[model samples]
Target: MPEIRNFCIIAHIDHGKSTLADRLLERTGAITEREMQEQILDDMDLERERGITIKSHAIKMDYERPNGEKVIFNLIDTPGHVDFAYEVSRALKACEGALLVVDAAQGVEAQTISTLYQAIDQDLEIVPVINKIDLPGADIEGVSQQIVDLIGCDHKDILQVSGKTGDGVDLLLEAVYELIPGPGREKDKPLKALIFDSIFNTYRGSIVYVRVMEGTLHKGEGIRFMATDKEYDAEEIGYLKLEKMKTDKLEAGEVGYVIGSVKSLQDARVGDTLTTTKNPAKEPIPGYQEVKPMVFSGIYPTDSDDFEDLRSALEKLQLNDASLSYQPETSKALGFGFRAGFLGLLHMEIVQERLDREFDIDIITTVPNVEYEVHKMEKSEVVKKIVDNPSEMPDPGKVEQVYEPYIKASIITPSEYIGPIMNLCQERRGNYINQLHMQSNRVEITYELPMAEVVFDFYDRLKSSTRGYASLDYEFLEYRKGDLVRLDILLNGDPVDALSSITHRDKAYDLGRKLCGKLKELIPQQQFEVAIQAAIGSRVIARDTIRAMRKDVTAKCYGGDISRKRKLLEKQKEGKKRMKNVGSVEVPQEAFLAVLSMDDD
Candidate 1:
């Protein structure tokens, strides 16, 4: 029997995880020259289209050694975003070791630091790979040291490889064989498997991913998912060995897939234990942590008529991803949409793009939001506050609370922009930390800032302010008390809670003016004049308006090709359908997306 190995590649965003996977695929001759596409592991259309690794892909490669030894490699690629940390964790559980990829120029980043700790927590051996060595800003030596410092390994221990040029790629494969330990499952024991991942297929029903610990499985066998206590006959037992092709069976100390006519999602929990009736394992795999989506927002159809379609789309997505949560709620402002929770903003974007592109639905998102704790004198309450403008906050009474989540932010940039960057961070209530010099001209600065500060348009501001030379990464820390108040935007006298927002006093004016400016553009010239008021409580801080359209109808509308005139009126009605009316004034979807565009103006 061939010695089997399973490993996963992990990294921070843009650290070249997918590229490394591509080089490995190429090195093993698994992909032909024509099939030699970039970032082949990024299989999802959105993942490839956006050039972001939102989903993970895996493949098996057959390796031959000069010493006449043969081995099978199961390489799994995983998402780097903290939002998908749970998915990463599940992948990690199936592996005995990991290829921890880091951008040579960027050193360690937010999710890198976060996921590294998770790998360590899982007791998996680490094999650090410094990628992007072919790039202009490569800091191979300095980043090597950072790896040594953070991971407590020597500089010689870090492997420097460029997935782009395939430099040192052969050595990366060598390390996989030399450094990573082989699977630890003992054959005599009963069957114990951890279902790391799963997906639903139209023809196959549901397919589950599992790492076998003991015993073996075969076709027509019976098995049980521990969580659901549901048993299903193994219609097929397979290995993703060469392709997603099937095998007669997969032995213990291997990773493979199980497919049957399954339906319930509960049968395929990420951390669930799987066992067979022939023999039962005494204990399940040790490490398990349920992943929860932290950020939420309303998902609605741009056309209110497609509300049912939106519901079905969300349901279809939820069927595959059990972590996605939803609560049916009515938006007093936007009619009805599901309040959906996601792992993070990127997760929110992936869902939105899939809805807009895959399902061909026009979704109106009410802003990516977070859950908040409303503290009162008597008791504390948790609430999902979708405050876009602060004017709707009730008068302070029976309460004493001001808290917002903060994050530790790490920014890598050219040293030339450090001064302005530092000033901007200070203005946003960022607490300073030390900086490290990388290469000859690059620096990595660390800071702790409220998540709210960066949650808005700070990304754009940072890019524009730094002349696009900076990269930033952050993860949630703890909530802290600050001088915070709700900022509200009013369309006429009625407060639109969708426009109500909580912000630090220092940033309220800028955010308010910026938000109001967006509303001004989104609000077309109404039949009647409409005031766009941004305020704190009743105090209006910024004001703009959509002056009523005067003489909207030209004599041309009545006379031209009368049929063409009718077509123009129909077009006007369709345009009006795209606009969301808040009370009497019409606001377009661009208005919500443009909420942060005022900074450019």
Candidate 2:
């Protein structure tokens, strides 16, 4: 147990976390020269294609010190994006220490500070490491001072390493062996392992990734999940290296994978406790909080006959991604579907793409929105209801008040970009808080803004305006009362529930106008004019028209009397009116996607 060092790497996005992990693996001889690659832990093709890590990956490493002391290291690599903060939190729970990596040239940024606070809250030992020292603009001294101020550690304790060149990684590994404490061993106690993550395997059922806290788990033993109370025989037990290395048993203070006959992920939930059926633990592990999704959208099959297939695909996907939440729903225009909730827009996009590529299912996603709390008067009683879909909102006459979620956002950037960043925030209805000047020429500013405002394109705009120099991190603050209304979009004369949204009253008119204009350009022209209208209740606030396609019906009457031309034109107008009444507009998929990028106009 003393020789077992369990730790994870945490940092902001693109701060060499994965590269550092590769260097550490190479230094420890975990992977050979033939298997070396960039972002070796990010095995997903989507992750490598986008140059980002969306999931947390764990692997085991073995190393021997210069003094002939052998040690076992369990390393977990985590994502740095704010959307995956929950993943970082889950990874922290299974480790005793963390390697907080900061970019030497970029200094300390917003996500760095955000993840640092999470690590501190977990009471994990913090080891500061400055990465990317090989860069020409590397400022080791400036970044070291920033780390000292952030973690309050001595100057000599900070290690400088370049993940690209593998410099100082050996020393960093030594520090991990010396600084990070080992997990507590209780071999004699009852079996109690915490399931940090799990994935569904078609051949082996559910493969559970766990950190054993007490006793030993042997192959072919009867195990039970404490939360679900479901018992299954452990088919195989092994350590998680580059691949699953089979072992007869897993001891306490070790992290590994357990293959059981558990058929569903719900039976092996993340944060659930695992124990032997004969001698179970007295209580389950603590500090497991349920994840609350911040964004909501409806997902439907392109062909209504594939509804059942879509449900099964989502269920399989959810087995791998525990953060996704969904329930059955129906829309007037989109037909039967599920209302899905996600961590953020990026999370939603990844799930959508996975459903298409992995499951081979065609899907249509509605406009994304946030959950709202609606307090309405029902038979002289004030009842509060949670409404994620705009069409589910109660009538205006029965409403008392509506509350929207807000967030506390922190941004870190160079001093020169402060003005532009502040102006951008102000445009999003942000309330200024306070600012702090750091050691370098960087500033950290805080703001209180509605989560709805930041959900759509805020991060993209921030990156473009600051030329990718700004970093942002935000957390849910509270739900506050606001003058909010449901904005409905009508095509021809019928409302399209899939395009409806709930927004603040002040921005509704402008947003509606922009949406109508975008839809006008995206929606194709029909045989009759298609009237696109945005309305709040019965009052139409914005409108746009797509003219009908004419076939030159009066061309034969050009050499005839004026009355004949008039008669032919009248006949054409009447035919259009009849077509407009019976013909339903076929809204192209692009129209639904246009609502997502309305801010670009």
Candidate 3:
């Protein structure tokens, strides 16, 4: 049997993971010159534009060794955002080894360290590739030292290659073939294949990506999900010779696609196992970890009629990514907003971007939200309330405690920006972890902070302080009891209905006051003056005044410009039509975004 090698490229955001995959595909002749697309591994338009791999994409290529031996290589690429780290982990589990791409200029980033530790835990052989060697500021030696100090890897084995220039890429390939051993096959073992990632195909149904570990899987083979025990006859079992190109069968130790009698996407659950009943492997593949969404928000359309379309779009997205959990929810005030669950804030943003850009839906997104715990003093119990609004927290005084998620963060920036970052962290109630210095004049500072504290504005604040030179990454550390309260904002002296949420008391004070001030700015002067008050229950926090409009007269029309007078009336009607009437006040999209804007406060 021919030897098969399966590996994944893991890197921090913008660390050249996809770029290296591009050159590897080119050198392997898996893609013809004309077939090449920049970052082909990033299949989605959003992925291409964002310059991040949002989904786990795979491509097969052929490489000829120095001894003229042709080998088949299957490579998987994954997103670098912490939100989709679960997706990345699934991709890593499917591979026997990995290519750890670290930017020579950036050195060891938080994500780099995080993913490297995951790779180590998987016990997969890692080939550290210091990419972007062609860049002017690239420091191969310095980054190699980081690999040693942080990842505990040997400095000599670290391969320095430019994924862009294709310099020294061949050495990295050799290391893959030699050090990363070919996947082993147990011929006598039962059929056990892991579904690392899968997608819906119009013609073929749910095409489960199967990497055969034991026995061979043929076309029309009967397989069942080991976890769900849902069995189906495999209609078309094939290996990826190249994307969309399929062969007849996937032999043991090879990665391929299984597109047969799949009727629904629910059948092809990622991280599930597919095995033959007669000869199933004693144990399923052992590397998969469940990916739970970490961030959430509602997605609603402008036109009430488009509600169904929005729901359908979400369904299709969930068909491919089961990790994205959402349930249909309706509000008399807001109409409809999906209680969307995400792996992280970035994941939430990416989903919204895909919905707006790809689905072509005009959506009004609520603020990115985190899960909150609501305590009931009467019952002496706490209810986890991920979706918080004024209606749910009606009995605010009865609550004793609320727990929110917290994260361990690591920030990398210039030395000059350290003080500002430290101050910012301290202001957010951060417990300092440690700081390390690198040879290229960058510092790695660590902290433990409430996830809510770092949810928004922190990135912007960090960038503002550092002049856009800082990069931050964090992972959920744990959830703890916090001195939190629900801040509710009332516009026009009445609660703005939907603008109520929970936060730490200290955070709520500043955030509530700031939002009330912004709401005043957002609420245009109506026929009568409006009062914007931010509060927690009956206790008023901050107040802002929006005085009634001053002047409302039009310029006198000239004799020749009667048409101009008619045009003015038409413009007024159109503006009125666009403005939303809440009671007697008018609100626009800007008003909605203003309350939710990152820096509106």
| TM, every model | 0.82, 0.95, 0.89
lDDT of 2: 0.90
- Once fitted onto the true fold, the runs of candidate 2 whose alpha carbons sit more than 4 angstroms away are 303-309, 360-362, 558-561
Q: Between the candidate structures 1 and 3, which one is better when assessed by lDDT?
A: 3
lDDT of 2 by residue, 1-601 (tens): 3379999988888888999999999988999999998899997888888878887889999999999888999997778888988778878888999999999988898988998899999899999999999999999999999999888999999999999998999899999999999998888899989888888888888899999989999999999999889999999999999989999999999999999878888788878889999888999888666778999999999899999999999988887887899999998888999999999988998999999988899998887889999999999999999998999888777889999999999999888999988998998889999999988888999999989888878899999999999989999999999889999999987999999999888989999999999999999889899999999888999999999999887766648588888888898899999999999998888788788777644
lDDT of each: 0.75, 0.90, 0.76
lDDT of 3 by residue, 462-495 (tens): 8888897788878787778887776777765566
State which candidate has the highest lDDT. Answer: 2
Task: Summarize candidate 1's per-residue lDDT along 350-376 as a digit string, tens digits.
Answer: 888888887899877765655554454
